[model samples]
Target chain A: MIFAEQLTKSYRTKTEEVKALLSVDLNIPKGEMFGVIGPDGAGKTSLFRILTTLLLADSGTAVINGLDVVKDYAKIRQQIGYMPGRFSLYQDLTVEENLQFFATIFNTTIEENYSLIKDIYEQIAPFKDRRAGQLSGGMKQKLALSCALIHRPEVLFLDEPTTGVDAVSRKEFWQMLQKLKSDGLTILVSTPYMDEAEQCDRIALIQEGKILMNNTPENVKASFSDPLFAIRSNKMYQLLHDLRDDHLVQAAHIFGEDIHISSEVINQQVIIDALQAKGHTQIQLKQINPSIEDVFIKLLMHTESHEQHS
Target chain B: MNNIANNQREVVISATNLTKQFGDFIATNAISFEVYKGEIFGFLGANGAGKTTAMKMLCGLSTPSRGSATVAGFDVSTESEKIKKNIGYMSQKFSLYEDLTVTENIRFYAGIYGLSIPVIKEKTAALLQQLNMESQKNVLVKALPLGWKQKLAFSIAIIHDPAVVFLDEPTGGVDPITRREFWEMIYSAANRGTTAFVTTHYMDEAEYCNRISIMVDGKIEALGTPSDLKKEFNSATMDDVFLKLARNAKRIGD
Candidate 1:
C-alpha cells in the first residue's frame, strides 16, 4: 500500500525555477497495478523518486506500507524495489554476479527469494556467464528485474521499463509484469506510451507536474463527452485538411491510417456530403468508440487552451 | 483508396539483394525493397533484427558487404556522398546542439548545407513561424520539452529540402498527442513530394505508413500495404501481423 498527500518539488536553476511535482496526491491500494502516465519531463520520474525515498520532496508526505518515505527510508528501501529509467545494473559484472551483489546488499541470498523472480530469471539464466552489458535490450531488462526482485520486495517501482524497446520485447516485458502482479506484488509503473496505460488496473494521466485524471481505462474512455468518428479516404492529407475546416467538427486528428474526429452532431450523411463536395472520393466514415489515447488528447488540448486563455 | 495507385508512383529508392555481413554474422541477408516518391514507407523489425543495419546501408552511413542499391538517384556504394546530400536524416536522439538557441541551431545547420546568409535567415523565420515557436526562438534547445525538441529536430532535418528523408524511430518515448502532431508534419512533407523512409517499433505508427516491410532475422518476412498485410496474415492489427512474422525469427536480440 502507498499513500501521498500534497507532494510538491521544485528545481531552481540560475535562470528559472522548474516545478517538477505540484501537489501530487496518490493512493495505490495493496496488490494493485498503478500507472503514472505522462510525457518526458512531466514529473513522473520526480514523483517516483520522491516516493522511493531517493529524493526528498520540497513539501508534503508519503508512506509506503505504513512506513514514512523520509523517516523510515531504510525500512522502505527494504520493502520496495526501484528501477530507475536508466539501467543501473553493473554492466561489467556477469548476470549472476549482479544478482548476487543485489542479494547481498539486502542481507539475503538468491536462494531465499528464488520464487519471486524465477519466471524472469529463467529467461536469462542461459547467459548467466555473459556480462550484463552484452545482453540484449530485452535480456538486460529481464536481468535488471531479476536483480531487483532478488530480495523479494513487497512493491516494485518500474520507470519506463519498456521505453525504446522493440514491439515484441515491450509486449514480453508487460507479460512479465502481469505475472509479477498475479503473485500479489503491488506495482507502480510510469510510461509515456498510452497503449501501455491500458495494461494497468488504474492510471493517473499526469502532465506539467499535475494529475489530469485518474480512473480505470474503461471509465476514462467512457467519459469522452463528444461523439467520435473514424474517417479514411484515398487522399488522407487532403481529407484531414477538409475535415478540420468543417464547422461541425470540433476536433480532427489522425489516429493511425484514419482521422479520428469529434463532432457536435452525429450526422454521417452531412459529413459525407461535405467531403463529396470537396471532391474527396472513396470516403469511409463510421461512428466509433473512444480509446484512452483519445481521452488523453482531449484532456491535454483542453488544458493547453485553458492555460493560454488564462 | 486503392493500393494499385502506389505501383504507378515514381521509385525513389531501390535495392536488390542488399546484404551485410560481420564476419560470421549476416546482419542483413539479401533484403530487397523499393520505396516510391512522396509516400511514407515503414521499415519495421524487432530489436537486433537488422533494421538498423539495413537503414544504415540505405542511408549511406554503412556499406553493404555484397549488394547493389540506389538511393535518391545515386548508387549507395560509390555515390554515397551524393546520396547523403539529397536526403535528410533524423534519429530518436535529438540531433540538435542543446547548448545553442533555436535560431542558432538553424543557422548552424543551414551553414553546413552551404546556404547563404539571407536564405538561412528567411528559412529560419519561416520554420519558427510554421512551428509556432517564435516565442521560444531564443531559448536554449535543452530548455524545450521532449515533444518540442523532436518536432524541431524533424523540421531542421528537412529544412535543406532534400528529395527524401530517413527517420529512425523519430517518435520514440513521446506521448500519443505529440506523436500524432509529428505525423501531421510528416504527411505535410510527403504532400510536397518528399519521400519518407521510416523505421519504428510502434505498431500504430506502422498503420499510418502507406506501405510497410516487416523484417525478421535479417530477412524481410512481409511487405505490403497495411490492409493487404492484415488480410494476408488474417489479422486485424499491425501488432498481430508483426508478432506472426517475428515469431519465426531464428535470432532475437542479436
Candidate 2:
C-alpha cells in the first residue's frame, strides 16, 4: 500500500548538512504490518513524515495507495492515521473531546467509526471527561491511539509508539495493532524495542537514514554471518571483561542469563578453555541462534566502522 | 551476589514498612526491601505500580507517609540532605545540560559535589581520554551523538564517587552496541564497590542485575536474583518473570 523509491531528505544545521534519509526505499503490501526498527535519531520520524505526506523529501518520489505523495498530499492526509512519537493532542481537551475533534476534522463522527476504535476506546471510556493532559502515561497513550483510529484510515503510521512504555502495556499495544491489521488496515510502526520487531510481518532495520536489512524477521536473524555462542559462569562480570579482552572475539555482550559472543572461528571448547583459565567456574557454553537484536548490533557495528574509515 | 549472603552484607538501602498516602490513594503500601552494598539492584514495575513512589522515598526526594528507610546509613525521613549528598542520581529525562560544553558540564557537576579544582581538572582529562572523546571535549553536549551523550552522563553521575548511584532508564532509545557499552560501564563502577540502583524496561538488562524487585499495585510482588525469580515464576527469561508478576497490576502511578 506504500511505496517509496530513492527517497532522500536532509536538514541544515549551523555547522553541517545532516542527511536524514538517503536513497531509502520501502514497499509495504496491503494488510501487512511493516516495522521500522531503529534507535533514536535514526530518521524514523523523517521517513514516517514522508510516507504520511506531512513533509516533503529532498528528492525522489513516494507513492501511497497508488497516489503520488507530493501530488495527492491532501488525500493521503485524509486516508492515513499518523501518531507522532511525541504525544501531539489537545492537552486541555477531555479524552472524549479529543476523539470527537479528530473525527470531526476527518469529516466523520465517532459513532460512524465506533467499531474501529471500540476495543481501544472502551478502556479509557470511564475517563472520557478527564483532560488529556491529566491522564497518566498509559491512559494518555490509549486515548491518543483511540483518536488515531476514530477516523478509520486505510493506513496507520505510528512513530515510536512504544518507546517509553512499560513491558506489559507495550505487549497490549502490539496486540491492538494486530487487531487493526486483521481488520485489513495496512500498518507502519517504528520502535526501538527489538523484541517488538518480531511482532511485525516484516521489518526494515534503519540506521542513520539507511535501511541496512529489509526482510522477514526470521530472514534477518538467519542472515547473521558470524559464529555465535552463549557463555556464562560464576564470575559473570569478570567473564565479560575476559571475553571482550580476547583478540579473537569480535563481540561479547550480555543476553539474559548468558553472555553471547560472536567471532570468526567460535569453538565451544576454545571459549570454555579461555574462560576456565580466567578462573571462571561453572562455565556453560552453547552454540546459539542469533536473535534480531544480535543481527542489528552486528549490522550497526559494520556500518559504524565503515563510516569511520571513510 | 547479595542473594547468597543476604543477612551478612551491608545493606546500603533499607526500606521498612514504607508507605505513602495521597488522601485516600496509597501510592506505596508498606513496601520493604534492602539493597546491599556493591550489588546491582534492578527496580522494575508497570506504569503505575508505585515504583516511582517507592524510588522517590528511597532517594529522599519525597517524605514517606509511614514507616522509615535509611540510605547509606542516613535516615531518609530526617537526613534527606545527608542522603542526597551520599547518593548520586541520573535520569534520562533530565540529563546533562545541552547548552554546556562537555568539559564545562563535567566541571560544573564535580564542583557541585564539592570536588577541588585540581581534582576536577585531573578527573575531567582522564574521563575524556577514557571515553575517547578528547577531540569533542570542548563541543556542546547537544552536538554529540546520543550514545556519547549517554556515556558521558553516566560517567559524570559517578564523578562524586557516591556510596550508591540511581540510574533511571539510562540506556533507553540508544543503539544496542551503546547499550551494552553502558552496561559494561555499570559493571566497572560496581566492581569498584559503588552500588548501583537501576530501573529499566529491558528484561535482558534485568538479567544483568545482581538482584531485582518487581513491583505490582503499590507493593513489591517478587524480589530475588534473576535466576531465582525465573525459577519461582516457572519462567525461562526475565521477561517472562516480569510479565508473570506485572500482568496482574491494575493501578497506574502518576
Candidate 3:
C-alpha cells in the first residue's frame, strides 16, 4: 500500500525554480496496478523518487506499507523495489553476479526468494555467465527487474520500464508485470505512452506537475463530453487544415490517417457539404468513440483554457 | 497543405537484394524496397529484425555486404558521399548540441551541409519564426521542452532542402499533442516534395505513413499501403498486422 498527502518538491537553480511536484496526492491500494501517466518534466519521476525515499520532498508526507518514507527509509527500502528510468544494474558484471550483489545487499540469498523472480530470472538464466552490458534492451530490463525483486519486495516501483524497448519487448515486459501483479505485488509504474495507461487498473494523468484526472481508463474515456468523429479523405493533410479552419470544429487533431474532431455542431451532412465545397473527394466521416489519448488531449486543452481564463 | 498524390511521384530510393553480414550473422538479408518522392514511408520491425541495419545502409552510415541500392538517385555503395548530401537524418537521440543556443545549432548544421552564411541566416530566421520560438532562439538547447527540441531538430535536419529525410523514432516519449504537431510538420514537408523515410515503434504512427514495410528476421515480411497491408493480413489495425508478422520472428527480444 502507498499513501501520500499534499506532496510537493521544487528544484531551485540560479535563475528560477522548477516545481517538480505540486500537491500531488496518491492512494494506491494493496495489490493494485497503479499508473502515473504524463509527459516529460511532468514530475512523474520526482514523485517516484520521493516515494522511494531516494529524494526528500520539500513538503507533505508519504508512507509505504504504513512506514514513513523519510523516518523509516531503511525499512521502506527493504520492503519496496525501485527501478529508475535509467538502467542502474552493474553492466560489467555477469547477470548472476548482479543478482547475487542485490541479494547480498538485502541480507538475503537468491535461493530464499527464488520463487518470487523465477518466471523472469529463468528467462535469462541460460545467459547467467554473460555480462549484463552485452544483453539486449529487453534482456537488460529483465535482468534489472530480477535484481529489483531479488529480496521479494512487497511493492515495485518501475519508471518508464518500457520506454526505449521495441514493441514486442514492451509487450513482453508488460506481460511480466501482469504476472507479478497477479502474484499479489503492488505495482506503481510511470510512462509517457498513453496506450500503456490502459494496462493499469487505475491511472492518474499528471501534467505540469499536477494531477488532471484519476480513474479507471474506461471511466476517464466515458467522461469525454463532446461529439467525436473520425474524418478521413483522399487528401488527409488538406483535410486536417480544412477542419482546423472550420468554425464548427472545436478540437481537431490527426489520429493516424484520419482527423479526430470534437465539435459542438454534430451534423455529418454539414461537414460533408463543406468538404465537398473545398473540392475534397472520397470523404468519409463517421461518429466514433474517443480513445484514451483523445480524452487526455481534451483534458489537457480544458486545463489550458481554464488556466488562461483564471 | 496538399495531398501530393503518390501515383505520379518519382522514385527517390531504390534497393535490390541489399544485404549486410557480420561473420556468421546476416543482419540484413537481401532486403529490397522503393520509396517515392513526396511520400511518407514507414519502415517497421521488432528488435533485431534488421530494421536498423537496413536503415543504416539506406542512410549511407553503413555499407552493405552484398547487393546494391540507390538513395536520392546516387548509388549507396559507391556514391555514399553524394547520397549523404541529398538526405537528412534525425534519430530518437536528440542530435542537437545541448550546450549551444538554438540558433547556433541551426547554424552549425547548415554550415556542415556547406550552405552559404546568408542562406543559413535566412533559414534559421524562418525556422525560429515557423516554430514561434523566436524568443527562445538565444536559449540553450537544454532549456527547451522535449517537444520543442524534437521539432527544432527535425527542422534543422531538413534545413538544407535535401531530397529526402530519414527519421528513426522521432516521436518516442513525446506527449500526444506534441506528437500530433510533429506529424503535421512531417505532412507539410511531404507536401513540399521532401520524401520521408521513417521508422517508429508506435503503430498509430505507422498508420499515418503512405505505405509501410514490416521487416522480420532480416527480411521484409510485408510491404504495401497501410490499408492494403491490413486487408492482406486480415487485420483491423496496423498493430495487429505487425504482431501477426512479428509473431513468427526467429529472434524475439534477441
Candidate 4:
C-alpha cells in the first residue's frame, strides 16, 4: 500500500536543472504487483530512489504502509526491501558473505528468513563460496534478490531485476516474483522490458518524467483505440516502406518480418486490395490483437497528436 | 565481387569440440560453432548455461580443458596474446573507473590498446559528439547516469577499433528507450564492419541480433536468425521459443 500526492523530483546542476520526475500522483494497492514501465531517463529509477528513501523528492508527499517516506524514513527503510537496477552489493564479498552481511544489517539472520528466499538462495548455494564479482550475471542477480528478501520486508521494490539476466533466468525470476506476490507482499517493480509489463497486476507507463497511463495490463491494452492489422509478403521490406507512404495508414512500422499497421479503416478487404495493386503477392493480412508495447506506442502517438493540436 | 566472397569465407572465430572443466565438473561440453566476419551474433542462455565460459575461451581469457578454438585468426590456446590485442571485451558489469572523467576513461582505454594520443583525442571527440555527450566530457563517470555510463563504456570498448567486440549484457538495467538507442550505437559499429558478439537477458533485445545461439546444459540447442529459431521451435514469439527450449532442457535432465 503506497500513496503519492503530486510527487516531484528535480536535480539542480551548476548550469542547468534536470527534472527527474514531474508532479505525479500514484497509488499502489496493498499486496499487488505494481509495475513502473519506462525507457531510459524516464524517471523510473528516480521514482524508486525516492520511494526507497535514498533520494528526496523536491515536493509532494509519499507514504508507504501508513509511514511517510520523508518523515518516517528510517522505519520505511526497515519495512521494505530494495534491489537497485545496478548490482550494488559488496563485490569483494562472497555470495554467502553478502547475504549474511545484508541480513546482519537488518538485524536478522539468513536462517531466520531462509523460507522466504530459499527458492532463489538454492540456485546460488553452490556458488555461495564464490566472490560476488566472480559470479555470472544471472548468479549475481539471484544473490542480490536473495539478499533483498533476506529480511522479508512487507514491501519489495525491484528495479529492473531481470535486465541483465538470460531469458531462462529472467523467466525464472518472474515466476519467483509471482510466488512472492502470492505470499501477500506488496511488490513494486520497474522495468524497461514491455513483455514484463504484462506479468504485473497493474502498471504505470512513465516517460519524460510523467505518468502517461496507469491501469491493469489488459485494461491498458484494451484502451488502444484504433484498428490494427499485421501484414506480411514476399516483399516485406518494400511493403513496409510502401505501407508507411499510404495516406490511409495512420501508423506503420516493421515488427519482425511483418508490417504492423494501425489505420483509420477496419476493413481488411480494402487493405488487401491496396497491397495487391502495389504488386505484392503471397500477402497475408490479419486483424491482430495489440500488445502492451503497441498500446504504449499508440498512446505516445496520441500524446504527440494532442500536443500538436494544442 | 571477390571481396564479398572472401569476407563471407573468413571465419573470425571457430570452435571445435571445445570443452571447459573445473576439476571433474564440465562447465562447457564438447561444443562447436563459427562466427563470421562482421556479423552481430547473440550468445544466449539461462544462468549456468556456459555462455560465459564459451566466451572466455573465444576471448582467450581462459584455457579450454579439451578441444580447440581459433579467435581472430589465432589459435586460442597458443596465440591468446594476439587474440587479446585484436578483440575488445565489455563485461556485464562494465569496468570503467567511476572516479575518472569521461575523457579520461576513454584515454585510459585507448592507452591500454596502445593508441596514439592524437588518434585517441580525435576518436574521443567524434564518439562524444555521436553520443551527444560532448558537454559531459569533463564530468566524472560516477556523476553520469546509468545510460550514459553504458554508452561511454561501449565507446571505450571500441576506442581502439578492435575487429571484434564482445558485449556481455551491455544494456542491462537500461530503460527501453535507452536500450533502443544503445542498440543503434551497436548497429552503427556493426555497419562499420565491426563484428559484435553480445549476450542479453531481455528476449526482445535478442530479436535485434543478426543471428542467435541458445545454449542449454553446456551445449547449443538452437542456432539461427531469431525468426528462424522462433519458427523452428513452433513458437510465435522469442519468449515462447526460449520457454520451449528451456522446458526441453529440463525434460532431458529429468
Candidate 5:
C-alpha cells in the first residue's frame, strides 16, 4: 500500500551537508507489517517524515495507498496514523480528551470509530480521567495509539514507540502492533531495536541513509554464510580485548553472556588458545545460527568498508 | 584488569532501604544495594519502577524521605555537595553542547569540574587522540553522529576522573557495534578504578554488568549477577528474567 523510489533529502549546514536519505526505495504491500530497523541518524525518521507527508523530500516520488505524497498530501495525512518518536499527546488534556481532540481535528468522532480502537483503548479506560502527562510511559503510549486510531486511518506509522520503555513494556507495545496488523491495517514501524525486527512480516535494515537489506527476518539470518560461534569465559572483557588483538579473530562483539565471533580458527579448542592462551577459565564455545543482530552487524561493517574505499 | 577483579574490592556506593516519597506516592521504596569499586553495576527497571528516583537520591539531586545511602564514600543526605563533587553523572536527555566543538566541549566540562588550565589542555589533547577523533576536534558536536556524540559525552563525563560514573541509557539508540564499543569504554573506565553505575533498557547490556538490580514497584526485587539471576529465575536470558520480575510491577513509569 506504500511505495517510494529514489527518495533523497539533504540538509546544508554552514560548511557541510547532511544527507538524510540517499536514493531510498521501498515497496510495502497492503496488510504487511514492515519494519524499518536502524540506529539513530540512520534516516529512519527522515524517511518516515517524507512518506507521512509531514515534510517534503528534495527528490523522488512516494505514493501512499496509490496517492502521490506531494500532490495528495492532505489526503495521505488523513488516511495515515502517525506516532512520532516523541509522544505528541496533549499533556494538559485527559486521555479521553486527547482522543476526542484528534478525532475532532480529523472531522470524525471517537464513537464513529470506536470499533477500530476498542481493543487497544479499553486497556487505558481506567485512567480515562488522568491527564496524558500524568500517565506512565506504557500508558502514555497506549493513549497515543488510541488517539492515532480514533480517526480510523488506513495505515499506521510508529517510530520507535518503545525506545526508552522497559523490556516488558517494549514487548507489550509490539504485541499491540501485532494485534493491529491482524486487523488488516498496513503498518510501517521504525525502531533502533534489532530484536523487534522479528515481530514484523518483513524488515528493511537501513544505515547511514541507505537500505542495507530488505527481507524476512528468517531469510535475512539464513543469508548469513559464515561459521559463527558464541564464546565466553570468566574474563569476558579481557577475553574480548584479547580476541580483538589476535590475528585469527576477524570480528568479535559482546552479545549478552557470550561473545559472538567470526574468526579464522574454526576449531573450538584452537580458538580457545587464541584467546590470549591463558587466564580465562570456565570457557564456553558453541557454533550457533546467526541472529538478526549478527546479520545486521555484518552488513554494517561491509557498508563501512565500502564507504571508506569509495 | 584481572588483578583488580579480586575479591578485596572497595565499596564505592552503598544503600540501605533508600526510599523517596512524593506526597502519597512512594516513588522509590526501600531499595538497597552495594557497588564495588571498578565494577559495572547495571540499574534496571520497568517504566515507573523507581530507577530514576533511586538514582536521583543516590546522586544527591533529591533528598530521600526515608532510609539512607552513600556514594563515593560520602553520605548522600548530609554530604550532598561533597557527593556531587566526587561523582560524574550523564543522562541521554542532556549532554554536551551541540553547538560547541569536540575539544571545546571537553575543555568546558573540565573547567566546570575545577580542572586547571594546563590540566584541561593536556586532557583535551589526550582525549581527542584516545577517541581517535583528532581530525574532528574542531567540528561542532552537532556535526558528529549520535554514536560519536555519545562517545565524546562519555569521555567528558569522566574527564575529572570521579570516583564513580553514572550513565543513564548512554547507548539507547546507538547501533549494535557502537554500543559494544561504548561498553568497552565502560570496561576500560572500570579497569581504571572508576566504578560505573549504568542504567539501560537493553537486556544484552544488563548481561554485560558484573551485577544488576531489577527494580519493581519502587523496590529492588532482584539483584545479582546475570548468571545468578538467570538461574534464580530459571530463565535462559536476562531479558526473560526482567520480563518475569517487571511483569509483576505495580508502577509503570516514564
Candidate 6:
C-alpha cells in the first residue's frame, strides 16, 4: 500500500544541518501489519509524517496507495488514518465531541464509522461526556484512535500508539489493531518496544536514520549469529558489572536477573573462572536462545564493529 | 513470597485500602501494595486504568478520595509537602524547557527541588559524566536526540537525590537500544536505595521490573514477579500473560 524510493528528510538549522532521515527504500504490502522499529532519531516519525503528507521529504519519492505523497497530499491524507506520537486531539472537548469533530472534518458522521471503531469506541463511550483532558492517558489513546478510524480510512499509521500506556491497555490496544488488520485495513505502526515488533507481520529495524534490517520478525531473529548465554549469581548486580568489563564477554548486559552474554572468546571455562574470581559464586550459566532484543543487540554490536573496522 | 513485608527490609512506601473516586467512577479501586527501600516497582495497566491517578496520589499531586498512602513515611493526604520533597517525577513527555540549554534545564529543576548551587554543580557534573554527554551540556535541549533528552530528563529527575523516583514511561519514543540503556540508568538508581516506581505499557519492559502490578478496569488484576505471573497465567511471555489477564477472556482460574 505504501512504497518509498530513496526517501530522505533533512532540516537545516542556522549553524548546521540535521538529517532526520537518510536515503531509504521501503515497500509495504496492502493490508499487511507493518512495523517500523527504531530508536527516537531513527526517522520512524519522520517517515510517518512524510508518508501521511504532513511533512515534506528532502529527497527521493514516496507513493501511498499508488499516489505520490508530494503530488497527491490531500488524497493521501483522505485515505490514511494518522495518529501521531503526541496526543493531537481537542483536549477541552468531550470524548464524543472530539470524535464528532474529526468525523465532521472528513465530512463523515460518527454514526457512519461507528461500526469500524466499535471495539475501541465502546471503551471510551462510557466517558463520552468527560472532557478529553479529564480522561486518563489510555482513554485519550483510544479516543484518538477512534477519531483516526472514524472516517474508515484504508490505511492506519499509528506512531508509537502503545507508548506511555499501561500494560493491560497496551495489550487491549494491540488487540484492537489486530482486529482492524483482519478487517483488511493496512496497518503501519512504529514502536520502540522490541517485543511489539513480533506482533507485526513484517518489521524494519531502523537506527540512526538508516534501515539495518527489514524482514519478518522470525526471519530477522533467525539471522542472529552468536552463541548466547544467560548467567546469574547471588551477586547479580556485581556479576553484571564484572561480566560487562570482561574481555571474553561481548554484549554483557542484564536481562532480568541473568546477565546475557555473547561467547565472543569461546572459552566457557575461562569465563567461569573469571566470574568465580570476581566473587560471583553459585553462578549459573546456560546456553540460551536469543530473543528479538538480544538479536538486535548483537546486530548493533556487529554494526559498531563494522563501523570501527571500516 | 506473597507477604514479604514482615521480614523488615524497610518498606519505603506503603498503601492501605487505597481508593480514588472521581464522582461515582472509581479511578483507583481499594488496592494496597508496598515498595521496598531499594527496588523498581512497576505499576502497569491500560490507559485510564487509574495508573496516573494512583501515581498522582503517590506524587502528592492529587488527593485520594478514600484510603491512605504513606510515601517516604509522609501521609499522602496531610503531609503532601514532605512527600513532594522526598520524591522526584519524570512524566512521559518529560517536561524540560526546550528553549533552555541542557545544563540550564538541570539547574532549573534542581532549583525547583530546592538544591544548593554547589550541590547542583556537583550533581550535574557527575550526571553528564555518567551519561557520556558532557560535551552536549551547553547545547539547547531542543538540539539533542530524543534518547539523550530522555536520559537527561531522567538524570535531572533524580538529581535531587530523592528517596523515591517516579518514572512514567520515561523511554516512550526512544529506540530499543536506548531504552535498554535507559533501564540501565534506572537499575543503577534502584541499586542506590532509591525506590523507582514506574508505569509503562511495554510488557517486556514490565519483565525487567522486580515486581509488576497489572491493572484492569480501575483495579489491580495481577501482581507478581514476571516469571511467577507468566507461570500463573500459563503463558510463555509477558505479552501473553497480559493478554490473558486483560481480555478477562476466560482463563482456567476465571
TM-score per prediction, in order, is: 0.97, 0.96, 0.97, 0.77, 0.95, 0.85
DockQ, computed on Cα atoms, for candidate 6 = 0.32
* Candidate 4's DockQ: 0.23
Candidate 3 segments exceeding 4 Å error: A305-310, B1-6, B252-254
TM-score of chain A of 3: 0.97
- Lowest summed lDDT across 10 adjacent residues in model 4 chain A is found at A301-310
What DockQ, between 0 and 1, does each candidate earn? Answer: 0.58, 0.55, 0.55, 0.23, 0.56, 0.32
The CA lDDT of each predicted structure is 0.88, 0.87, 0.89, 0.81, 0.87, 0.82
Least accurate stretch of 10 residues (summed lDDT) in model 1 chain B?
B1-10
| Cα lDDT of model 1 by residue, B1-254, tens digit | 12225446888999999999999999999998988888899999998889999988988889999988999889999999888888988887758999999999999988887789999999999999888899999999999878888889999989999889999888877766778889889999988989988898878778889899998999999999898999999998889999888877779585
Q: Estimate candidate 6's RMSD in Å.
A: 4.4
Clashes in model 3: which pairs?
none
Superposed by TM-score, candidate 6 places the C-alpha of residue B58 at a distance from the truth, in angstroms, of 3.2
| Models ranked on lDDT | 3, 1, 2, 5, 6, 4
How do the residues B13-41 of candidate 5 rate in per-residue lDDT, one tens digit apiece? 99999989999999998888899998889
Question: What range of 10 consecutive residues in model 5 chain A has the weakest lDDT sum?
Answer: A301-310
Q: Is candidate 1 or candidate 2 better by DockQ?
A: 1
lDDT of 1 by residue, A279-310 (tens): 87888988899989899888888776334521
Off by over 4 Å in 5: A305-310, B1-6, B252-254
For residue A259, give model 1's deviation from the true position in Å.
0.4
Candidate 4: which docking quality band?
acceptable
Model 6 Cα lDDT, one tens digit per residue, B25-119: 78789889888987788888755567778999988989989999999999999999999999988876757999999999989999999999999
